[model samples]
Target chain A: SQQGEEDPQALSIQEGENATMNCSYKTSINNLQWYRQNSGRGLVHLILIRSNEREKHSGRLRVTLDTSKKSSSLLITASRAADTASYFCAPLTQGGSEKLVFGKGTKLTVNP
Target chain B: DAGVTQSPTHLIKTRGQQVTLRCSPKSGHDTVSWYQQALGQGPQFIFQYYEEEERQRGNFPDRFSGHQFPNYSSELNVNALLLGDSALYLCASSLFRGGRYEQYFGPGTRLTVT
Candidate 1:
């Protein structure tokens, strides 16, 4: 069974707008990572936030994690048509296992 | 350096037949993991291999077996394929056995079972 679930199964926005996607998990985790997948392609790692961290930023990507609430959010600012893809959140288990349980993911479309 | 790579970009198979998918981890990486993603679902963990051994596995059945070679490359074999088994098979490579390490993924092999 999947441990995490992402909200807003799909989102559509115009280019240059901001896109935000949320994910919630049921178990304790060591870290949470986000990924982006283009159509019919593999995933690309976006960012990872440890349990002790609250927020992180990389270029136009911002991620916030609320361990108390067991949730995390990804914010993509100045979205581009190239940003259209599926986004997934994966949470690592507390046992320090190499496996990462992933959420259903959010399909984002940035129209130019 | 090349990222993770998988072979046979696409495949078609019949029910009850077997299929083998291969993966070469990113340069200098040691661990490899496999995942299955349905059309609209997230990628599910199939198993993980480390030091030429099956370190951990997900809830998949015995029919889904795998092997890790001495070179850290891996192969996923599904015997007696079922229609439901048709999905994108992804191979990911990580540096270590812990969760803090980042994983690099391959383009994946799309399998269509008849």
Candidate 2:
């Protein structure tokens, strides 16, 4: 299964604190994407890290990828209550056209 | 610009009935994909359509099918629905830039099979 297995099935933190989630996959990938889903609604794409890239930052979000370990991590800084949601990671395999195989995502809660 | 949009935000149908869900991709997107997300589970890919034809499929059964229109819109149809078919149906769209592109998801249509 090439599904990206997210770690820390659930996490709780205070507003202004940072939250981190990890994902591990079983196969090589071209890139990894992180998304946030609020209350089980539509998912909002957060960031994407290519295989050659080690780290990338977008506003308050930071993503790191370690292809050697077949793992990736997403970090949200200065979290707000609105950040409370399920975070999913999709390890996109090479040659597959957006056929994302997702694993159970990490649920994060930010207490205001 | 509008993102992906799905119709019939919610639906309720009895087992053995058929249901059709619709989706319109974001502007300029040429590919459409469908997924099923059960309660408390990650979304599972059903199939993907490009150029109005199924370019790739997941492990889903034939009972789960889809079509893409020339205008880049798509529809997902399930025949003889089962209780287990109740889930959040999500439609995503993206441009097939060779292979790598971000998918914009719709709000999804929640289906209940009773």
Candidate 3:
């Protein structure tokens, strides 16, 4: 079973606009990580937010974790056409060796 | 530094046949994990290898097995493959500290079981 579920299964936006996707999980997690997958490729690590941290930033990406809600969100500011890809949120399980369980993912399309 | 690398970027096989995929971890990393991703779906954990041993695995059946070499490279073997087995196989490498959990991924091998 998937530990997390992301909302807005698909999102379409114009370049330079901001794209935000949210994920909700069922169990407690030690940390949450976000990844991006281009078409026909493996995933690329984006950012990671530990349970203790509320927010993190890297370049045009921003992520926030709310442990109380067991949810997290990824924000891509000033999106580019190249930013088009699928975004996934994977939460590390608390017990059982810290393996990650992924959500169904949100597909984002940035139109030029 | 080279990131994780996988072999046979793409492959096609008939159902019931066997297939083996390989992966070399990223430089300086020691742990390796495998994932299977179907079309339009998120990747699912297959198993993880560390120290030349199977450490943890996902819900996959016994047909899915793996081996890790001393150099930290690994192989994922699927026996009696099914049409459902077709998917992208991804290999990720990471270092296991006490509680850290960051993993780097390879470009992935696209497997199509016809």
Candidate 4:
């Protein structure tokens, strides 16, 4: 079974609108990282938030982590058509192996 | 700096055949990891290699094995391939810091098992 589960598997928003995606995990983690993948392409690292932190911001992306609830959310503000892609949250386990398990991902389509 | 690179972007093999995929880690990176991604799903970790030795392995079977060279480049070998073995094979590299890493990924080799 996958360690991370994302909600609203697919989303569509008009250009300039905001998009928010949520994720829930089953185990404790050391850090949570988000990645974006264009259609049929490799993933690009977006942001990484340590477990001790609650929120992080990078450009138009904001990520919030709630360890107590074992959940995280990614918010993309003032979106554009180029932002259309698949977003995945990978929770790194607290171990030497540094395992990075990914969820099915949330597919976002920003209509121009 | 050069990012991770994989060879033979695409391959086709029949069932019961064998295939070897290669990867070169990002410059200055010493750890390498492999993943298998079926369509419509997330990548599944195959194993990780460091210092010319395997450091970790996932739930894959013995038919799926790997090797790492002194230069930190790696190879993933799938023996007795099955139809289900077809997938996008990805290689990732990272600097090992206290057992934690921010991995850099390759474009991946797409394998088709006939």
Ranking by DockQ: 2, 1, 4, 3
**Model number with the top DockQ:** 2
State how far residue A28 of model 3 sits from its true place (Å).
2.4
What is the DockQ score, from 0 to 1, of model 3?
0.57
- Indicate the residue-level lDDT of A39 in model 4: 76
Candidate 3 lDDT over residue span B38-101, tens digit each: 9999899999999999988999999999999999999999999999999999999888664556
Q: What is candidate 1's TM-score against the reference?
A: 0.95
Which 10 consecutive positions of candidate 3 chain B have the poorest summed lDDT?
B95-104
Q: For residues A56-91, write the lDDT of model 3, one tens digit per residue.
A: 999999999998998999999999999999998888
Worst 10 residues of 4 chain B by lDDT: B95-104
The runs of at least 3 residues in candidate 4 whose Cα sits more than 4 Å from the true structure, single-residue gaps closed, are A95-97, B98-100
Task: Look at candidate 4 and tell me the lDDT of residue B93.
Answer: 90
**Error at B52, model 2, angstroms:** 0.9
Q: Which candidate number maximizes TM-score? A: 2
How would you encode candidate 4's per-residue C-alpha lDDT over B41-83 as one tens digit per residue?
9888999998888888899999999999999999999999999
Error of 4 at B3 (Å): 0.6
Q: Going through the candidates in order, state the TM-score of chain A alone for each one.
A: 0.94, 0.95, 0.92, 0.94
Candidate 2 lDDT, A1-112, residue by residue in tens: 2689999999999999999999999888888999889985988888989899999999999999999999999999999999999999998876346688888899999999
Q: After superposition, how far is residue A56 of candidate 2 from its true place, in Å?
A: 0.3
Model 2, position B22: C-alpha lDDT score: 99
Q: Candidate 2 on B1-114: residue-level lDDT in tens?
A: 999999999999999999999999999889999999999999999999999999889888899988888999999999999999999999998888755468889999999999
